[model samples]
Target: MLEKKRVQQLDIPSREGYDAIFNSNFLEDVPAALAQWGSSRVLLVSSKTLAAQHGDRIAALQSALGSHRLANTKLGVGSHSPYADVRDIARRVQRLRADCVISVGGCSYSDACKAACLLAANLAPDFTEEDMEALVDERRGIADARPEDGTPLRPRACRLVAVPTSLSAGEWNALSSATNARTGKKQHFGGWEGGGQPDLILLDPELAAATSPERLWLSSGVRCVDHCVELMCNPESAEGRCEGLHGHAERGLRCMLGGLTEYKAAKTRARGAGEKQQQQQGTQEEKEEAGDKERQLLLEGVSECQYGSREALTGLLIWRVPMGPSHAIGHQLGAVANVMHGVRLLATPSPSPHSRALISFKTRPVSNLTLPPLQITSCVMLAPVLRWQAANLSNPHYKTAQAKTLAIFNETLGWREASAADAVERFVRSLGLPTTLRDVGVVSDEEVRRIADKTMTDVWGGGKRQMEFDDVMEVLNSVRG
Candidate 1:
């Protein structure tokens, strides 16, 4: 925690110079910008939720767009993040022939608008699935591996303006993330040529003013934790946290705790009678302090949690410690656990990867994690799973089912391996994750070792650097501990 100059500063597009700053539910800024541009046909873009709550405001924005209001589309229902859905949205935009697309709402809605801009600007290629899938995978994780030759959709890019509701930071980034349904992986576009970056951005707290304490809390935690985790995993990154490097990790941790406090306070206020929007009546310095606090927490603790917590900012250019074997295992568990996607990470006692402060969470929130929708047919899993599935592919009986479930179980509780040695299962029982490899279906310590040996090398990315076979056996042995 000693280096100094490495800091991941949030990019502020307001510095890039925009003609107008459209506040939330921007029915207000529409008229002035349109009058200045002397353009007709101001198309309104929104989502189903947004169309319902703020449709009148949007209509007002449309009217303000002046006489030439050609057409607009509200996109939701489909995962706008998926490339196929984005393309569909793009086709709709093309048919509408919008001059400009104003994205309203969170990252998902904004992303759809960005995709549409590409198609309209002729910065994209044909809507082939393979081409789209190839593009999405290249942008999934923490790197820039885009091709120089580009691809089919390179020609149809467009200039865009984004209005973000959450703190995913897409407003400042030049790239957009979409999922490739074919591969079930997130894809990145822009950061080059036509889709490189947005030409303008407007951050109106009022946009976020619509957020709920629960969602705000979740999104806040997600963003702050993501920043913290990314900073820890990539201490050497240009825009990374500074623990050994500086006090960045500490600052980030404070920010996290700070945000938690803010949320709790806001929650209390919201419950009492105050509106959901954080009181904006405070001084600029106060707001800035809150923002910094949010940014700091993001820079610290986020790395300790797994990838799921950071899902809100999925495709944005944030540093993320790719979810390791534990997270993958958790995903498998989440596929069946009664908790939501990221909550298991909180419950699991992850190894301390951070070089900073540790703040205890106030409450153990109830998670809706469950065992459905998680068709763990071909995921990277702990080793016994490899052994069992191969050994008994046809058995849908409880024994096999339990064995398969064990892989997700042991990993969640952080058992070295599910064993009968020390009643380690007792401890996990305290936390509630499954206790034995046998609880799920793992048969022996040998099987545990085999699984750990495998989990550390699963291709989806993470590996157990120290949790080797013997380590896995320890967990299995710990079933008694």
Candidate 2:
């Protein structure tokens, strides 16, 4: 359970290159933060869902910005940030002459804003698909863009401010990703020399509580868990330069696991109480009081999760360590299968003891006959990949990697006797999240092959172990169910 405390601002390490303010009130804090940044003429970007749900809050922000300062507003950015949508956002930025961009939703919105900024700053008005693709493929920065006359482009002036409503933590990084419209493949964009990252991040627990879906909030926290675990076990982490990340990863692991567990438990209790109250035909006032308490509990959990995610990403952002197969394959799975980046489909009424037994055996395939069709977060793939690494004793880094995994289990989670992979899978199951691809609707062998093939091209695909196509296939197949 989260310890009771007054709301407090936390400091981010200087190396991360931005400022983050954690509070429960965005209506007051967001305008104040923007004021400090001197951002007039702001372009607000959000999703259709958020715009509908938070119309009052959106209006308040617009009022705070004032009519002349509010340059434009764009809504309905699709998931995975489609390239056309990004280009459209860029066009709006250039045409409206906005001085700043504010992303008011999840990581997808932030990614679109960042990518649009890069495109608007570097590329010409008539830049082709090939030109954009080349920029993403090479991960080039503004420094690489030179005029035919040998002049360098000026550093971009437009800044990004993120108001993330989930725990995806993409706002913390300089890099961003968008999907190719034609091929349905997600492409990364950024590497801007002077800009293209969020200059300010606002962590409003109220916004998260109000806007984020329950499954999204919990599973994204697990994504942070993926970040912590993979970084701790990354081969480069054993080296002197990367050793600093271990401490941060450990702290992140502890905070995420503890906070998520508490949050889920609290949510369960609140749900039960609500059901009981409904049965009793409780008064409207009583129900409202219960709802308020529930919201406070959720806010507490969200605050911890925000801190945990920050810690998880800090070292990786500073060191630029690439994550392993899970992230690589997850990217493709999201683009190909239309999987959400962070979501877990809970099996109704829970699994039977026999089903649990089947799930326990990592190598055995479980029949999906009795289960309902459900979607899951891509980070659920982490456990099986960890097991693959642990079992591949022939690999030089396996021993240290396994040791790090064991340490996380022992030191962070306080579990004993279980293998690292099993512990992770069990924890995910405890949260009622699926740990297999079959659970998320990727059942066929051919589908697995396609995802594995695409995984190789991901920036983090080979990583420190230098994983090959067969290696990637093996990892995916293990979790194929």
Candidate 3:
């Protein structure tokens, strides 16, 4: 118990050089990025859908680089960063002798391209499919693997520039997930040789607004919220290590949540304008203005997510604190259950019965820190406690070291006296996200069981507050509903 009160030191992870630019029509900056990366040959990795939508921009980039320098374009990349796809992409990069890789579209394109860049830099020229998969599998989220775990692997040979269109924010971290071809489970890789982090990130609001359904943008904002909350709650921060005045976690949460709220408003306005257009009430000019408004709002949201991504990655790099169970289970949900990554994070879930029981037992002898027992139930409960702390707590830094928690449930979801779990459920409902496992398309209890089993082995699993296998069963049973 006393050990829990002490702040512990953490090893800083290696972060390579990179640049980020935010503006509309910033695709023009690609050539400059290429130049900064010192690449004479460039490969553009994007999806066919994006190519069709932004053909002119692609053409312009190629024109800027001149046809001679543009090595090749690989389009129609798959989602979930499928293992075979990445390997194939790597082979293409190697064959073309591309010096820089540019990823467009969303998480899938960027993740696949990042893996390809890493492989092109490190692997032997004649590496086989079996060899690539074996290496990826071996380094896939080994918990104890650090920069100093051994000699640093080869520096990435090809530089990467990520241009994301959705809110997945995979480009911001030095880690990417690729699905294993055999089991359909997503495996984590990168961070060893800074293979995951991109050399440059371009945030062009107009491009981000093109994402359909508007749900991806909104829910992925919640995923950023999850990242900030966990970093704040992590009790692993050392006393003097980067313990500066800046509150990275709190700032991150503020940016993410505030961005989501603004984006929601913009989406509502856009829908209204579209409906008006359907009714033939709004003029063409008004419709254009509405579209521009939505685009600007989308850009704002993306920028906020980018800022939060920096803070989250900084915490991950400095503290080396394992990602909380929410991330662990969310990855499994994406890989095993086929739920989209953002949707998995946004899905409303009930508290695991075993976790509830653990909280009850632990809080039986209440202490002065005012920690909420029910907050232990699920990751969705993060918002309320954080809101409470921001409003009530005096300490600038959340003293998770002394209390082993930062959660202190108060009014959230606009509810006066609801439990944290209930509040979270209601909040997620307000966002129109799935409220249960079945709602997100889980097929069976056995599938949920399999996900729970695999989650235990995830690199992010088994943290100080993680639910064990039996506890995971209780959660799965609730999700089965």
TM-score for each of the candidates:
0.51, 0.84, 0.75
**Candidates sorted by lDDT, descending order?**
2, 3, 1
The lDDT, on a scale of 0 to 1, for candidate 2 is 0.69
TM-score of 3: 0.75
Each model's total of backbone clashes: 65, 0, 0
- For model 2, residues 182-281, the per-residue Cα lDDT tens digits are 6657777655232556777788877787777666677677788888877877777767877578788888887888778777877888879877886787
Error at 184, model 1, angstroms: 1.8
For candidate 1, write residues 52-145 as lDDT tens digits: 6656655665556655554555645233265666776676656665556667555566665665566445424455656444443332331123
Over the full model, what C-alpha lDDT does candidate 3 score relative to the true structure? 0.58
**Native-to-model Cα distance after best TM-score fit, residue 327 in candidate 3, in Å:** 0.8
* Per-residue lDDT value at 296 in model 2: 79
What is residue 393's positional error in candidate 3, in angstroms?
21
Report the C-alpha lDDT of model 3 over 258-293, residue by residue, as the tens digit: 566666777777778677788876668987887776
Top-down TM-score ranking? 2, 3, 1
Model 2: CA > 4 A from native: 1-17, 138-155, 192-194, 279-293, 340-377, 393-397, 406-417, 463-465
